[model samples]
Target: MKLTLIAAASTAFMFSLSAYSQDMPGMKMDGMEGMKMEQETKQAPVADAEGTIKAMDTSKHTVTISHGAVPAVQWPPMTMAFSVTEDQLAGLKVGDHVSFSFRVKDGKAAIVSIKK
Candidate 1:
């Protein structure tokens, strides 16, 4: 009778061990999934401006521009002279009607490209 009881207790312990082992992979202390990870990518902001060049200053590498309203990006087009790089000024001329792509950083607009 004692041998039978011992065998039954051993079987119960083994069964409980197997059940606990099966659950080990999915157990989470904070009630979160352990094996899944997620990552998000950030996209750069782009704005399009189409306008006529009012003036060009190759010495300062800046251009004065006047553009139509850019409603798609909520930027009201206006006349302004902006600082640009020497490489950007190379292809541009005064009074040229151009469409351009720009990005805003630190409250200033930087021209990315110009298309005639």
Candidate 2:
């Protein structure tokens, strides 16, 4: 469909401009089928990376990071938001570079551990 292609293209553009990892397609949860579903649901393996904090919202309990490509999830270098715990967001600020461990489930990334 036209919308799917457009969405895919838009995501690709955004990822191309992102700072973290590079080159792993398929971010939408609604359209996934087969291996795509497997990729989105696979969460046992943790991916590690170092990146700059782009934004954070304590109320939302999420942090946006600009990081390099994460092979574990096939994510391209780009900025993306991750759900975090209050402890994970503590003391971290925009522009702070930190290392973190995370896993992806249903196209959502959740931080397991983080430190500056």
Candidate 3:
């Protein structure tokens, strides 16, 4: 009777461990939880503006542009320096007329692309 009880308890313990392994919290068994969240919280659309480059700081990877209103981001026409990637500044220069795309997050603007 004791051995039979022990055997049943051990089997139940093993089955519980298996169930936990398959039902862990924060572990997406279906693998579509991330995709569902991604589809739900859609990203803000990219915004574009036309501007003249006022200054270019290659060392800082930044550019100051006098841009027209960016209606998408509700920004007025203004001169402000924005961080840019080296690739975006490849052939860009000060005083150049260019159309650019940017995203403003956390009150800081970052230029995504620029073209004359």
Ranking by lDDT: 3, 2, 1
In angstroms, give how far residue 11 of model 2 lies from its true place: 51
Order by TM-score, highest first:
3, 2, 1
- Candidate 1 lDDT trough over 10 residues, lowest sum: 35-44
TM-score of each: 0.56, 0.61, 0.64
lDDT of 1 by residue, 8-109 (tens): 999999999998778566655685645454433333476788899999887976778898886655778689866678887777788899988777666777
Write down the lDDT that model 3 would get: 0.88
Ranking 2 against 3 by TM-score, winner: 3
The residue-by-residue lDDT of candidate 3 on 1-116, one tens digit each, is: 99999999999999999987795587656866456566567655779999999999989989999999998988899999998988899887888999999888667788878899
Q: What is the TM-score (0 to 1) of candidate 3?
A: 0.64
Q: How many residue pairs collide in each prediction?
A: 0, 14, 0
> How much lDDT does candidate 2 score?
0.87
Estimate, for each residue in 1-116, the C-alpha lDDT of model 2 and write its tens digit.
Answer: 99999999999888878945755576665644544555566547789998999999999999999999988777789998999999888888899999999987667889999999
Better of 1 and 3 by lDDT: 3
- List candidate 2 segments past 4 Å from native: 1-43
Candidate 3: count of backbone clashes, pairs at least 3 residues apart or interchain: 0
